[model samples]
Target: MGPKIKQINRRLNELATEWNSFDLGPSRRETHSFVNSSDVIGRDKDKENIIDHLKEPSEDGNIPVIPIVGIGGLGKTTLVQLVYNDDRITELFPLKLWICVSEDFDLPRLLKLMILSVNKEENCDGLTVESLQTCLRSLLNDKKFLLVLDDVWNENRARWIELRDLLRSMDGLSQRRSL
Candidate 1:
């Protein structure tokens, strides 16, 4: 009975931790790619490192995923903004798409956001996943592009793989980078 009680307590603690983590109260303000370079300070070295990585050729022929991870309020987004706005990045990838992915990782919603990033005027409200993929492929085909999926919080491996495979299906995305 004692061991069973301890096991139950352990399971309860795990459940509590999971619950607290998911009970995020307020919605975070969506982030954008634009930033005033003059206002940012002290992240030059980090920015340069990411830029160097981006400039390097992908040895594996896969779309390189560069994640800027840190605790909340630590300016991860700010550093990424600096990298995204850099002239070198712009020169390397002419077509840039920035999507603020907060919390939920719905595939159709993410697809719609990607489409909106490509063309803001696009009406993507009623489109299915197939349509969104087709449209995104049209915009990205044979073009050097950079996609920034910002503030991602999804932890599901299958969903991530689905998104990755979706990108992999595109023609010119083999050597592109996503941050």
Candidate 2:
């Protein structure tokens, strides 16, 4: 690995160790909450640019992948959440899916998540990767979809290519697809 990658891995390991050692009250339970749109401050320009990009049509008629790259805690997730929840964006893309891809980038897991996100009632147990991909394709057929893979840390080119190829197969069914 390169020095930068090694540094990142080391820092991540350190953080994991620190997190594991942190103490919470015995009765405490972690609660997850989203930042309300009203409470999000100082990201109007970033939201606008992303929204504008989403509104623009690709000349090649292919799906566009817009990446929001930044270091941790820089509000990249918040910005995308704002854009994802925007009225115009919702209207433009009828189907929206958000998958949190933090550190674990297993293709089968991702496919299952996508299927579940499309329809919460889906039974994805024991399904192979090909079957999962087929189910996802069916759910996305004839729809304009926005898929947000948040906190993606996988950098394997081969794995990415495999996932991209699977997603690319859905292009014919999707009017617009975002990642």
The TM-scores of all predictions, comma-separated, are: 0.83, 0.79
Which stretches of candidate 1 lie above 4 Å from their native place? 1-28
Q: How much is 51 displaced in model 1, in angstroms?
A: 0.3
TM-score of 2: 0.79
- Candidates' lDDT values, in order? 0.88, 0.80
Q: Give the Å error, residue 167, model 2.
A: 1.3
Residue 59 accuracy (lDDT) in model 1: 78
Which portions of model 2 miss their true places by more than 4 Å? Answer: 1-34, 171-174
What's the CA error at residue 85 for candidate 2, in Å?
0.5
For all predictions, the C-alpha RMSD in Å is 5.4, 8.4
Model 1 gets an lDDT of 0.88
Candidate 1 lDDT tens digits, 1-179: 99999999999999999988998765856889988999998999999999999998877867799998888989899998999999999999888888888987889988988888778898888888899999988877788888899998878999999999989988866558999
Q: Give the per-residue lDDT of model 2 (tens digit) for 1-179.
A: 69999999999999888877885423322211145999989999999989988887767745578988978789888888888888898899888988877777789998998899899999999999989999998988767888888878889989988987777777553456565
